[model samples]
Target: MTQEYVYDYEPDYDQLMADIETLIQEGNLEGVRNLYETVHSVDIDEVLEDLDDSSLRYFLFMLEFEDISDLLENAEEDLQIRMMELYSTKELIEIFTFMANADVADLLGLLSTRRRKELLNYMKKSDSNILKMILSFDEESAGGVMTTEFISLKQSLSVREALLKIKDIAPETEIIESIFITDRQHRLQGIVDLREILVAPGYTPLSDLIEDMPFFIYAEDDQEEAANIIFKYDLKYLPVVNQKMAILGVITSDDIIEVMEQEHSEDILAMSGVSKDEEYDSTFASSVRSRLPWLLVNLVTAFMASAVVSLFEGTISQVVALAAAMPIVTGMGGNAGNQALSIVLTSIARGDMDLEDDWKLIVKEIVLGLFNGAVVGLFAGIILYMKYGNIILGLIIFASMIINMIIAGIVGFLLPLLFDHIDVDPAISSPIFLTTTTDIFGFFVFLGLASIVLPYLV
Candidate 1:
C-alpha cells in the first residue's frame, strides 16, 4: 500500500515534480489514486490546488469516495465547488454525508442557490433537517460552527448498556472524545469520558459514571467564545447547549483551531485595509477595489495634515530650521503611537480588555509615552543646543517633542476606544487616524513653540 511510503522516504523535489509530471502524462487513474493514498489529505489538497484544472480533475476522479471526502474537507472553497459540479447527485450525496455538519453548511453556502437546493433534495431527510438547523444560525455563532453528530446517553443507562449502545453508534459518529448524558427531556446533565466508561463497573449507572456539571457553551454564544473555552480548559471537545440546557452539538478543538486561525487571518487583512475575502489570485481590479476606500480615507486625512502645515507657511519661511526639524518630532511620535496602538488593538480583539479597564490602560500608556518622550526629547534638545548653541531653540524643540508625544499617546489610546465604542474596527482606525493626529499636532506644537521662543534667542 502507498501508506508504506512514509515521511522517511523523502523524494527529492525535482524527482517528486518529475513523478507528478509522469503521473499526468501516463494518465492511469488507478496509479494516480494509489500515489495519492501514500500522502496525507492535507498534502493532497495542497497538491491538487497547485495543479491545473485538467490534472486536478483527473486525480480527483481516480480517488475513492472516502478519500475524495477527506480531501474535499480540506480543499479550498472554490475547489470544493468545482469538484461538486463534477460529481453525480448520488456521488455528491455520499461525500456530503461523510462531512461534518459544520463543513456541510459552509460548503452549501458557497454553492449557487439552485445547486444548493438540488443537493439538499438528494440528502436523507434526517441529514437534510440537521443541515438546515445548522444553517439557520449565523456563520460566526456557536450553533453554526458546531457538529450535531455528538454522542449522548440517557442518565439511567448502565455502563454495560452504554458500551453496547456505543458499539452500535460508533460507526456513525466521528471524534467521540466524551459522551453527553441527557435527562428524559433531553436536557444535558453531565459528560462521561471514554476512559470512565472503560474503567467503570458494568452495573454503574451513567449518572454515577458521568462527570457532574461539565464545562459547556451556549448555542447562541459567539464561536470564538466556544474556542476560548476549549483552549482555556485544554479540552478535546466541548458541548454546546441552549438556555434551557438542552444539548445542541459539540465543537471539536480542531474546529475551534480552524475558526481561530481564520479569524486571525481576517483581522490581519482588516489591519492591512483589505477585505476578508481577498485572495492572492484575485484580479488586479478586485485588489484595487478592496484597498481603494482606505487609501481615500487616508488621502483626505493627509490633506488635513497638510492644511496644518499650510497654516505655518509664514513660520516655515521665517525659519527654515523649523521646517527641517519638525518632521523628526512627528515621525518619532507617530512610530511610538503606532506601537502602543497595535498592542492595545490586539488586546481588545482577543477579549483581554474590558470596558472598565480602558481607563487604566489609557493611563498606563500615557505615562509610558511621557517617560519615553522625556528621554528622547532630552537627547533631541541636546543635539539642537550643540548644533546652534541657542538655548531657546533647544528648549522650543524639547517642549514641542514632549507635547507631541503626549498628544500622540492620547490619540492612539482614545482613537481605538472611540472606534470600539462605535463598533468600528480599531486596527483599521489606529494607524491612519493616529498618524494624522500626530503629524498635524506635532507640526503645530513645534512651529508654534519655535515662533513664540525665537525672538528671545535670535
Candidate 2:
C-alpha cells in the first residue's frame, strides 16, 4: 500500500501582485489601502519599494498613519527616505505625531541635519521634546529604543475616571497595553492593564485596581538586557524608569524582536572574525576594510599552528604514516571543539546558562568529547593495525586521538569565558583561539606519540 502525500500550504504572491496592479490601474486608493493593511509589514514594504515615488506617496497617504508607520519601520533606509521626500514638512509633522517617539527620532536621524532641524521646528512641542529625549541616548541603548507615548494615570483617579482618561489618550498614545499609575510627585506606583480597568467597579480608585509592581528597566540598561526581560516575563511592553522611579518610556516586544535579530546576526558575523554589521549594500572597498582585521587574525593563528608542525618536522621526515594521519586528528578535534562551543554560546545568549555555571557545562562537554574520541580512535586504531599489521603504530594513533580530543573539549569551554573576562566578545574570539589550540595540540600529541612508540616505523 502507498501512503498519500500531504503538502504544506502557500500564499499566492503572483495573484496578490496582479491584484495590486489592477487596483492601481483603476486608481482605487481605498482598495490599495485595504490590501496594504491585510498583508504583513515586511511584504507591504517590499511592494512599496517597487512603486514610483508618486504612487508610493499616494498609497502612504491613503493608509492610516499607524499602517504607514509600520511599513516605514520595516522598509530599507533608502526606501524610507524616498517615501519621506514626498511629504511636506507640515504633512510629515502630522504623521510624525502619531508615531512612537523612538521611531520618530530614528527617522529624523536618517534625514540631513538641516532637514532634521527644519522638521523639528514644524513639529508639535511635545512631540519634538519626546523625540529629542529619545535621540539623546546611544542608538544601541534601551533609551534609544523606547517609546514615550505610553499612558500614565494618577493614583487618585477612580476606575471610571481612569477609564475615561485612557479613552481620551488612546488615540494619541502608541501603546495601551498597560496604564502606569503615578503618585502626586509623578512617581511610579504600580500598573494595570486595560482588562483590569474594564472589570473593576466605576467608583473604585486606581490604587485598588493596580496589580503588584510591574517589571521595569532603567533607561541606561543595555538594550540586550531589556530584550531578556521581555522574554523572562512574556511582557508586551516593559517600562523604563529613572533613579527617582519616574516612568520615562516603554520598550515594546516588537522593538525587542528587532534588537535580538540584529544582535544574533552581529554575533554570527563576529564569530567569523568580521567587524560588526558589514553592510550588504556596501562598496567592495568598504567590505574589504570590514573583513581585513579578521583575516589577519586568522593568518597569525595559522602560523602558530604551523610552528607546532615545525616542532614535529623530524618525526614526519622519519615516518610518512605520521604525516598522513596528522590532518585527520587535528581536523576532527577542531570540528568537535566548534560544535561544543556553539552550544555554550547559544545557551549564554538565551540566558539559560552563565559564567557561574561554567564548570558544570565544561565537565559535560569533556565527557561527551571523551566518549566520542574513544569510538573514533578505536575505529582508527583497528584500521591501522589491519593495514600495516603494526600494533605499536595503531597504539600511537589511538592514544593521540584520545588525548587531543579531551584537551579540545576543555579548552573550547574555557576560551570564551576568558575572552569575556577581558572585555572582549567571546563568540568572536573563541573559534579562532580554539581552532589554533586544537591543531597545535593534535599535531604535537600524534607526532610525539609516534616518535616514542614506533621508532622503526619513523
Determine the C-alpha RMSD for candidate 2 after optimal superposition of all C-alphas. Answer: 5.6
Model 2: how far residue 259 lies from native, Å: 2.1
What residue runs in model 1 are displaced by over 4 Å at the alpha carbon? Answer: 1-18, 386-391, 456-458
Best by TM-score: 1
Which tens-of-lDDT digit does each residue in 175-254 have in candidate 2?
88778999988888988888888998999999887776668888887888888889878988888887888888988898
- Can you write out model 1's per-residue Cα lDDT over 1-458, one digit (the tens) per residue? 22233333444445444555667777766666666666667666656666777777777777788888898988888788777778887888888767787788888888888888888898888888888888888889999899887789999999999999998888888756688999998899988898899899999999987677578888888887787778777888888888899998988888899888987787788877888888999889999999999999989989998998898787778777777788889998898888877777766766666456677667777788788888898899889888877777778878888888888887877787778878787767667888889998998898878777666644
TM-score of each prediction: 0.90, 0.86
Error of 2 at 388 (Å): 4.3
CA deviation > 4 Å runs, candidate 2 = 1-41, 47-70, 387-389
lDDT of each: 0.80, 0.80
